[model samples]
Target: MSRPARAHLLSLDEWWESGEDREVRVELQEGVRIVAPRPRPAHARVVLSLATQLSDQLPPGFEVLIEVDVVIDPNTPATVRVPDLIVRSTTSVEFPITADQLALAIEVMSPGSRRTDRVTKSSEYAEAGIPHYWIVDEDLSVTALKLTPGGYVATGFVGDIVTSTPWPMRISLER
Candidate 1:
């Protein structure tokens, strides 16, 4: 016997209402729901370290958040991403943040999240018009990117210290 055809995609409201209480991290991509496993120790550490460093350097009216849901599509609401860290101004008040209010989105790659972080999420954030995106690997190497008219372009990559634009901050991953 052959497998049956899949059902229709879930609307953003429908997906939000489903709300099955679980520990897994969930996101929506083009009306499809994606569930990610919990972060490992290395991922958590990087997130914490990056958030702390960025938070301290952010000027007034800008703040750093960790593991927050970012609504990438305003027209359709089909994609909701939970970036590992986000930097946005204080003007946003809603629970799920919209793309325009965000300055940067950062993702610390986990074993399971490498592909999505590097490819899928990067594309989505760029399409959403977020200015900056950073990816941190397990080894603490960082890739800083800026969204241009064409797409995301790598600005810098460093294993220890990273100083990039859009944010006047210097990050040191040295132990």
Candidate 2:
């Protein structure tokens, strides 16, 4: 007997409808479906901490969301991604927020996601024209990047006090 062929990719709507009752986190990248591992305690801590800080300090028209799917390219539904946290304007709230509406996408690095966060996701976000991207390392160091005409440029790296542009907020990572 021959084995059945497997699906290598899923469109955004398909993935969403299929995953509605599932607990596993899934993301689509370059026409492929990827299963994301559950965040460990340390990773979850950073995610919540950052989300809380951003949500508390964001301006009136902006809001912070956790693990929300962002559609990088509506034409290619397989290009959806779920960032650890996203900062977006609240003026036009919508499900599966598009990349253009997002002000920032943040990823808390884990052993399994270091490369994806630093390289693949960075490139994707830049290509999608999201203005800002941040990577929070295991040690709590943060690397902030801003989108430019050429691509994403590292704006700053901070471990203690974080003060960056495009968002009028300061965060201290000291514990």
Candidate 3:
């Protein structure tokens, strides 16, 4: 049998206290601590490229937050997560955010992020009612998973170019 998953037992508040400590970034979900892999340059490049492309289309009132904390729930801390890119309609609050506060969450998938993006993070985004969730797969050269009640509905891939109005920003994702 496989070994049980390793998790840090801490509340969302505690995670915030040491958010940037660098040992690990912990997100509480269903009583489990998900320590995301350290971001690589490739991953950062994809996130920045996509953010820049989308930023140009954002309305004056909207703002794009890069690698920010988004609290998905007010009561239980189980759903708190930090998405790579978040498009918010307004600039409100400083840190430690709630899910309903965002319009869209974009996750750029690196080589090792398949399971997290497709499973854990996807579940959290949907359950929190995030209107749009983009899973940009560098491997497949596609953007998968449009948010739905059951799960992310498969949308067209970003082969050459992708045009989406997932939020206030009209984004184009291409290689």
RMSD of each: 2.2, 1.9, 4.2
Could you give candidate 2's per-residue lDDT for residues 54-111 as a string of tens digits? 8878889988889888888766446888899998888855876899999989988888
Off by over 4 Å in 1: 1-6, 20-22, 74-77
**Model 2 residue 82 CA deviation in Å:** 0.9
Write the residue-wise lDDT of candidate 1 on 20-112 in tens digits: 535898888888878878787867888898889888888899999888778888445488888999999998876668888899899988888
Report residue 32 deviation for candidate 1 (angstroms).
Answer: 1.2
For each candidate, the alpha-carbon lDDT, in order, equals 0.82, 0.81, 0.70
Ranking by lDDT: 1, 2, 3
User: With candidate 3 superimposed using the best TM-score fit, by how many Å does residue 108's alpha carbon deviate from the native?
Assistant: 1.3
Query: By TM-score, how accurate is candidate 1?
Result: 0.89
- Which segments of model 2 are wrong by more than 4 Å? 1-8
TM-score against native, each model: 0.89, 0.90, 0.79
lDDT of 3 by residue, 1-175 (tens): 9998875555666656654646555566654567766788878888888788777877778788887768876453445677889988777665556787777788878677788888877787888888778787876355546666676786765444444556343345543
Give the C-alpha miss distance for residue 66 in model 3, angstroms.
Answer: 1.1
Instruction: Give per-residue lDDT, candidate 1, residue 77.
Output: 40
